[model samples]
Target: MTRISQTTRLEKVEHIVGSGSGLLDFAVKGENGYDTWEGNEDADWTVEDVDSVQNVEEDRYIMYPEGDYFICEIEADTEERNSGPVRCWCE
Candidate 1:
């Protein structure tokens, strides 16, 4: 994953899509704490067999051919007008 875990903070947003919606449920990382375990520190998060990013959720950690990555976070835009980019960290 990018060495950006400690640098990036979850931006201020009005409507953040949380870990619910029956999505892939792994360890619940808060907005401030979600940056951990995404780099090369050897994580303790659970693993799921997701084939690709399209089948993943915002809370699930998956092992792919490249490696593992935090689930793509779907959050609202600046004005909560629409969905933002699906973002995640990997190793």
Candidate 2:
């Protein structure tokens, strides 16, 4: 007699960067149910996350299929370089 069943799926992410429009975005929910946007980083702000896009990182970036929480930020609009959209919170 043999019986085996193993299934695992966990995805909860939260990341933010938008104050001065540096660029870095993430917002994933558990069991796949939430999402956010702003990904793509660093247009040359002394290398804040400007590694030519694609998982850019300096302060925070590249968050997918992970686990963690407790991140809050506010300043959704500063006006400069694609100005706007910068608000975050993770729980």
Give the best candidate by TM-score.
Answer: 2
- Give stretches of model 1 more than 4 Å off: 1-66, 71-74, 77-81
After superposition, candidate 2 runs with Cα above 4 Å error: 1-21, 30-67, 78-91
lDDT tens string, model 1, 1-91? Answer: 1112222233321122233222222233334322222221222223233334322465643334233334444332232222223344433
TM-score, every prediction: 0.21, 0.27
- Local distance difference test, per candidate? 0.30, 0.31
Cα misplacement distance, residue 24 of candidate 2 (Å): 1.7
1-91 in candidate 2: lDDT tens per residue? Answer: 1111111121333433223335433344442323223322443222122222234544544432222542423232222333222332333
Give the CA lDDT, 0 to 100, for residue 86 in model 1.
Answer: 38
Task: Report the CA-based lDDT of candidate 2 relative to the real structure.
Answer: 0.31
Instruction: Supply the global lDDT for candidate 1.
Output: 0.30
Lowest lDDT 10-mer window, candidate 2? 1-10
